[model samples]
Target: MARSTAMKAAGLILALLIFTFFSLAASSSNNQIQILNAERRIDLSSHIVKVFLTLKVENVGTSPASEIFLAFPPSQADQLALVKAQAAIGKKKKKSYVHLDVNPTQLPDAPNGTKYFSISLLNPLSSGETATLEVLYILTHSLEPFPTEISQLESQLVYFRDSALILSPYHIKQQTTFIKTPSTKVESFTRVEPTKFAGRELKYGPYEDRPPYSFSPVIVHLENNSPFAVVEELLREVEISHWGNLQITEHYKLVHAGARHKGVFSRVDYQSRASVKGASSFKHLLASLPPRVHSVYYRDEIGNISSSHLRTDYRKSELEIEPRYPLFGGWKATFVIGYGLPLEDFLFESPDGKRYLNFSFGCPLAQTVVNKLTIKVVLPEGSKDPSAAVPYPVEQHLETKYSYLDVVGRTVLVLEKKNVVPEHITPFQVYYTFKPIFMLAEPLMLASVYFLFFMACVAYLQIDISIRK
Candidate 1:
């Protein structure tokens, strides 16, 4: 009887709380921001969701709007980079780019434990004023591997879960989401009455505006036979020379990031399977570099690999190489590739008499994912006060590194970065003043040494006769 009474008391308290919530909600007068239109584009070709959100927002509140907020689930915040944002103007839709100040806040009682970024507007919008925002970001590891592991001959399947109904803190006028699959083989998807499904594309809703914080979940399954390749570490070294050229070398520790094989890899079985149904494993990699790349070489810790080919023309340049061993799921291999480009193509000079060297972090295959990157750029022996302007966040250090004929060690700028993806393959410029006199110092010193050696030979020959007498 006591246990029953306790349970009844708990129920009575829950009922009282619900009654209080309704009573307060009915009396509340909350301001609403109306979303006029929204469009989301998801690129399924990658292991990430490259999302582009275009929103038209109107402040239906009584006061001016100074900021806007975007919410994401707690699980998706860590690897996301807010790539770009632009404010759109009147009918012609001209855009004036403005910098966004990102302020992140986590609320304890938020539905789904949502974490929001409050983007502060440069200019406050008046009530009833309309503005459009275009935002871009990549959601990494957004696809989940289904059946986690696959047999050597079986195809890979992945899953993507999102919402059919758009969820927002404010009321939405109308919204549509378009999903593009990586491959043409979309096996199945959630069959909801409000969605239209076509061959590789899924479209959801032209539904009427829904109340605040409403959502409906949807899921998709697809077959992707593409190799999921990742580099555990990529060490890129750049040496700058004032004479003519810039030399770049990269060492890669590569791994297949797809489903693991259930058993030991059998080459014979793989060959047999390839003859029947084309090999699903990674066979080759194509790396892109700036045009006019020369003296290209490929090797590994053991020795040189002969299976690399370089193609260069007026239009584009590419280096295609194959690993020593065929890369299957859970297998690893390492290799080094080096090339040289004209220094003028990447270096710049400032009117204030400073020299800047700019180079890309991109490898031959810029699309390949990398977990960590260490970049070292060696400046001239006397170059001083090295600083960097990079496109992404990085940790930097200055080290004394020397090369051939270097007396005072060159200034080596070491930049460390993590979680690199293809989209981050942008260039960064390292600035330092290179004194022109330093260029001729090495040549002049060599000439002096040759003159001294000639004089010494003559003196030794002239003194030999007197010694013999």
Candidate 2:
């Protein structure tokens, strides 16, 4: 009897949960939220979608509205990833920090693309009180191959699609989206009524407010021939030794994301096509180094690569590296490059008697996009009181590592950043102090060891105890 009662209780709880979920879903459909503006910018140069959505939401029906849910289509779930998201109260351009809860709940019965996300307002919206929120998110892989296949030398066309209306939990009042194409060679696109095209920009609509669950569709197709280089990871390291030198090294793992090459890569055909003015294949990366840096080295996972060139004596040094394989679409390559310079060039002693280092590092190649970047700075052992200032949105932390004859591990500053472009190669300032004793301790320790060894040898020889014994 007790078992039966427990089972009955469990069934009752499950029934209540199911009923509540359906009730909420029905209520959400009855009264919808409104979108005031939806502006989307597409950059083929970086293959990213930046969206700004201005929403006016309220609690019209009795209970307080704590949050709103948005979801992406199931078909698109595998192709895109969200890189950044934030929200602010009405027309707040400076962006208020809002943590988005992705895929908050799971419903087995829901449709295929039910990747639900939630946004919280600082305060609950009571009945009749409204709040406007500015929302922004970066979406990757916004384009897809229209033809699904292409020849090596032919241009590729990609297709893009978006909802005619912005997805919202509530009805939208007004919304518009302006899309800019990569090039002027647009082949086809959706022609919604009242749409306009000026140059490469396409404007969708200032459509009248839509009822709950209303629909519209926007699609576009455009031609592209540029080499799309996607760097999956970039690791940069800086070693600082007050003894006189600073070493910087960077490693890159990259993939070519342009149109797929239909056949095996041919050197003869490639060389002939590459000689043309504008070739789609990726050939080299250009790295910028300080002038007169003669200790630069470039290599891959293998021992050494000889296809690197260093041109110096100019305003700045440039390193041009040709990969072992000409990078075609869907191909991957990784390499490591490093250089050294005098520590005095970037070190300074402040009036407060503190030592500081201003260091910067970046890619040696041009027209490259880094998806993730992490830089580690290894300071000399026995250095103390560490602090750093990095010029990007990053997570900064410290690690410890030990090298030859080190009594204690050295302090390493680790700075990790995302979506790094070429311009992000800016300077970071690291501050630390070295005591007089610590500076002189290593040499003194070495001299004392040598002296003691010499004395022991002389003492053993002078005793000559072996002759008598």
Candidate 3:
């Protein structure tokens, strides 16, 4: 009897111990998973402004995971650049691991529980990991709209969602203003949802997750008649020469996103509609270029666009380009523009001893979808350790190249993002190390040729006249 009792007690103790151990393990596991807390701020005091975004991620898991990563929205990524970091998953330390990938064909999307960054834990995480990523960037406007439509002449309005507004560091009470089209009126705005700050966010509504192909319809009727312009794709290139010239080129496809006209355009009706300035479906497209950027030309796969008139003033340069045919609903227009600048206009030596190139240009899109955009910036010959970064939201390092007129064929930085609006055209900067020898080679070569020509001329003059003797 005593032996049996002792055996029963041992069995009960073993069961209790196993249950307790599992409960603790489960609790620990729950605690190890972490989420990212992000805070984004935009300061727009000057034409050039800085965007600072901070991300804090915590891990709550029992066993150590190999890695963790965070993903950013494709649109936001185009305008952001990773500047500094202090990241770690375990006792093992790492300098940086975050990367940006572009899906130009789709809007920015991320799965739940997916981290924007990844971390490798050292001592398999008994607890969780905590990390913070900070990004600093300069924002510039890229989108342009041609205010002509086919059917009804509508007043254009640029809509800035209250959600996209970021706080400024300089002011506590006053926030940065997102200026809308001058003629637009704030008809009726509402905040259906809560925001980080009260009275700031204009919410649309809440939605429940539905199956694929199921779309819940929510219509917002504001003064926003501005043709929903979107350049689904844009390719912008800024080539630098330590040797002394900056060449800028851009290729883009734009589509009309506003309400479409039903039937063929009638010129007589269009002429009469002109009296009522805001009723026609034709949009007058315009692009703003840098004041110093000249020799502006516009063309597409078909050929040169003759209807374009490029004008520059002391303050700014403008390109007024008209399509071969009036752009109706769902119409697409593609064109390329090229211009040049003295290298001295934007390149400067950084305090860190690296040469950096700074330039800004405009990219405009009508209200249509941009499928893909590839931007390639060519660096001059003899450039070493070339690296390029942009301040706009985008996917990065899509491809690298070594091409003509290049010592290293310049670093070709390509950015692809989708569903981009016109107002998002922001300036991007590229920084790299330059070789000084390249700066003088061309000038010296020219001087040597001139000197040799002069010497040869004098010798020929002295020897030729004696044929008579």
Candidate 4:
């Protein structure tokens, strides 16, 4: 027992030594890097909040720096939807942008449970070397409705909260924050110092010599009447047929995510005074679709809706649709959109003789957020070894779907994701193995049914063993 206790004590000592070493290393690395200049522009022109950040960073220490960390409070981190970064190369006049990899990471010594995402540089910055990075991040459901409830005639107002300084682990020399609202009708804003308000734009800072993790919270209240379309649930089904066609159907349960509507709605006032009445309500939405789409249809629970138009070109198709009624704050609608496409465009054969279908994921509607999204790819009967290749992380599983003339049912690959945004609308591929002979199953079944029906008719007409005879 004594020997075991001594061994355990020794292990604890070693672990403590290792932790101390790593902590010191991280501290040293943080001290080595600094931001020369930083600029942030917050665009609050719509329901969605978009932030653009530009940072000029340099390695002031004697070591190389390969990654930079972005700091965000826990509240904002939950609302973050998309983050993309690019690095500038060459001179200013003739420069190109290269994409950088940004991924969430955990650090043990983070203060106040701050979340961090590390942006990896293509090439490490040596001592005294500098690099410029441009980052664009999108946040959804970030704006808070001021009153939380409003009348139809009342215009919408929201509150946006953010930091005046750029949140970074490294020290910053100079930084500035600019905020642009939808209209010049600003209600109120929290001024940090050295702040300027001109028209619809608010400028904050040019703060200099900020230490690491410096933050100053600011809130802005402004007028914004843009539609806040949020899809509570969306299910997209893609059925592949080897007979030269691909079918896609999408079901949506949509809601207005802004302030709730109060009192009774006046249709007469809304129709006559359209310019001022129900300014916060929306009735029109647009969807972008692929080229050569056929048999496109849109409908709601009440049946086919005629208030829709489709424009097609060689490049792409645009679909404009309006709900049966204008969607006010807290209003809800359910609908479906379906279309068919040429199979040759989306289906392809691999070198290994496997078949795959390339299709777009996420809701087709523009500037909308989906709380829950489910994509189902139904493969033909007799398909085997089904798999999915999505660019991002998603919950994937297999299911069976029985269709017309299906004996063993079609194999379905289901991919589920939450908090889906417009940025999630990317191409995803579903791969499976299918034998050509399976194509004849439905045809043979139909032929057999027709032959049996003919034989029964012939016997009924020609045979003499009937009860009536």
TM-scores of the models, in the order given: 0.82, 0.65, 0.49, 0.95
In candidate 4, the residue pairs with backbone N, CA or C atoms under 3 Å apart (3 or more residues apart, or in different chains) clash, namely none
Candidate 2 on 1-469: residue-level lDDT in tens?
A: 9999999999999999998998776566336444444444545544555555656565666767666666556655543444334445444486455644333444333454555556665577677777655555555556676676666666668887876566554576676777777778889889887788788888878777776455576788887556677788988888888788888888889898766667655677777767442255678878888765768888898868999999887468889988998876678998898998788888898889988888774444566666777888898888888888775457889999887767788999888876665555678788898876776767887898899999999999898666665
**What digit string (tens of lDDT, one per residue) describes model 3 on residues 1-469?**
9999999999999999987787665344333544334455543222123445554545555566444333333334444322323332333364454443322221122233222433343334334555554544433332222332344444433222223323110111112222222232434433323222223223322222212112222222233333444464777787776656777777777666554445455666556664353342345677777677766677888888788887887777877777776655567777787877777878888898888777652354322334455666666655566566665566767344565433334456656665443434567676777667776755776788899999999989888676685
Higher-ranked by TM-score: 1 or 3 = 1
- Model 2 poorest ten-residue lDDT run: 100-109
Q: List the residue pairs that clash in candidate 1.
A: 287-364, 288-364
lDDT against the true structure, per candidate, is 0.77, 0.70, 0.50, 0.92
**What's the TM for model 3?**
0.49
Candidate 4 lDDT tens digits, 1-469: 9999999999999999988888787788788999999999999988878899999999999989899888888879889887889999998789999999999887667889899888999998999999999999989899999889999999999999888887788899999999999999999999889999998899999999999989888889888899999999999999999999999999999999999999999999999886589999999999999999999999998899999999999999999999999999999999999999999999998899999998888888998998899999999999999988898779999999999899999999999998888888899889899999999999999999999999999989997885884
Clash count, candidate 2 = 11
lDDT, residue 133, candidate 2 = 58
Models sorted by TM-score, best on top: 4, 1, 2, 3
How well does model 4 score by local distance difference test?
A: 0.92
TM-score, structure 2 vs. true: 0.65
Q: What is the lDDT, from 0 to 100, of the residue 409 in candidate 4?
A: 99
**On TM-score, who's better, 1 or 4?**
4
Q: What is the C-alpha RMSD of each candidate to the true structure, in Å?
A: 8.6, 6.8, 13.5, 1.9
Error of 3 at 201 (Å): 15
